[model samples]
Structures are given as C-alpha cells and as structure tokens.
Target: MNAPYLLPAMLALAVGTYALRWTGPAMRHRMRLSPRMIHLLDTGALILLAALVATTALPAGTDHLGLALPTGVAVGGVLAWRRVPLLIAILAAAATTALLRLLGVQ
Candidate 1:
C-alpha cells in the first residue's frame, strides 16, 4: 500500500500478465489439445459466462429474485442467439428491463 512500492508492483504485475498472454500464442504451435480438452474448455467458458450473467443480473439485498433483470437478460440472449446486431440486442434488453420496472414487475 505504500506509494513507493505501488509503481514497482504495478509494473511487475503488468509484465507478468503480458508474459502469460504471450505464452499461449507462443506455445500454440508446439502444444496440442485433445478434442475432449477443447470441449471442456468451451463448456467451462460458457459456464463461467453464465455464472457472471446470473450474478450481475440478480438484485442485491433481496430475499426474492426479481423477474425484470433475468427476463431482460433472456431476451438479449435470445436476440444474440438469433444473430441479431449486438447494439440492438443490448438496447432491447435495456428497454425490456425499463419497461418491466415501470410496470412494477420487480
């Protein structure tokens, strides 16, 4: 937390992160992933993304989950799955959330 150590710490972290990012591409040609491993990784990514969405959409400090946020997210997800433009999907989600809230659906 000291001011003097902050710069050095940040630099070290940045270098480490860069090295990690570079490692994957640098080793990609040398390393081979099995089909099962690839499938697992894809599934893991989807699961993580879903978890992030759930946590972000769920209301805080509440005993019961609200319908508006999840409904909006579902609408966005459906649009995205149908290959709709990202901006439109996002705007539709926001509009859905606003309308639900205005209708006192929380």
Candidate 2:
C-alpha cells in the first residue's frame, strides 16, 4: 500500500496480464491439443458457466432461496435457448425480476 511501491507493482501486474493474454493467441498455432483434451475444455467451459449461473441465480448463505431470481434466470435461459435476441432476453429477464420483486414475491 506504500505509494512508492504501488505504481511498480501495478506496472508489473499489468505487463504480466498482457503477456498472458498475448500468449494464448501467440501460441495457438503451435499448440496441438488432442481431440479429447479439446472436448474436455469445451465441457469444462460449459460446466463453469452453469455453475456461475447457478450461484448468481441462487445466492449462497441465505436463509431461504427466493423465487424471483431463479424464475428470472429460467426465463432468460428459455429465451436464450429459443434463439431470442440477446438484448431482448436480458431485458425480459430484468423486467421479470423487477416485476416479481415489486409484486412482493421476494
């Protein structure tokens, strides 16, 4: 937290982050991932995404899970699955959540 060290530390982190971001595209051509590895990576990404959605839709450490958030998320998911426009789906989800909250659904 010292003033003198803060800038240098930030610069180091910035450079390191940029290098990591650059390395992926830089090495993509040379990296030969096996089919199984590629499949695992794809599956892992989906699992991670689902986990993120679940956590956000139903927050942790709450006394009880509320209906509004999960219902809104389900609405969004269904719309997305049905190939609805992303913006419309997101707005619909937000609207659903707000409406449910306003109606005292908690």
Candidate 3:
C-alpha cells in the first residue's frame, strides 16, 4: 500500500549510470598514460566487463543463485569466443534464457 518512490529511485539510478558511462568517453582523450599503464588499464576494463557480465548473467537470490541465466551466459560466451556473429550469440543467449524461464526454471 506504500510503493511511491520506486519510479524516482529507478530514474535516479538510470541517470547515475549514464553519467558514469558518458564521462568515460568524454574524459578518455583527456587522460594521459604511459604505454604500460594503458595496457593495464585495458586489462582492468576487461575485468570489469567480465564482472558485470557475471553478475547479470547469474540470477540473484537471497539464498542461492539460479541455473538459468548462467547457462544462457555460458552458451553465449562460448559462441562469442568461437567468433560467432554477435547477433547470433545474443539471440542464442536470449533464447536459452527464454526456454529455461518457460520451463519454470529458477
């Protein structure tokens, strides 16, 4: 009977996320770094991406993670790693997720 602030909270989150994303490219050219530092930075970026992917692809729960999302991500990752087209990889992941969900998987 008291769910009033959800929309605002979500909008704020969206704004904050976009702000950080936008600043990345805007500040990218302004920053100066050594070649070694640049390589390390690139590695760090990839690590961040991996972490994001993991968190999203794994279903979150209070007690345990679910199997469906992770399975979909695994399929997608392999396809991507094998140099499959991006659209195909994404569609495969989506389809896997949908199928699992349709089967009432947690």
lDDT of 3 by residue, 44-104 (tens): 9667657766777764675776788888887887786667897998899889988998999
TM-score of decoy 1: 0.65
Per-residue lDDT of model 2, residues 25-88, tens digit only: 9999999999999999988966765676677788878987889988888787667656689799
> In model 2, what is the error at residue 66, expressed in angstroms?
1.9
TM-score of 3: 0.48
Better of 1 and 3 by lDDT: 1
Best by TM-score: 2
- TM-score to native of every candidate shown: 0.65, 0.69, 0.48
- Model 3 lDDT vs. the true structure? 0.82
**C-alpha local distance difference test of each model:** 0.85, 0.85, 0.82
Compute the lDDT for candidate 2: 0.85
- C-alpha displacement of 4 in model 2, angstroms? 1.8
Q: Please give the range of 10 consecutive residues that has the lowest summed lDDT in model 3.
A: 56-65
lDDT of 3 at 1: 25
Poorly placed runs, candidate 3 (over 4 Å): 45-75, 78-88, 92-106
Off by over 4 Å in 1: 63-68, 75-106
Q: Which stretches of model 2 miss by more than 4 angstroms?
A: 74-96, 102-104
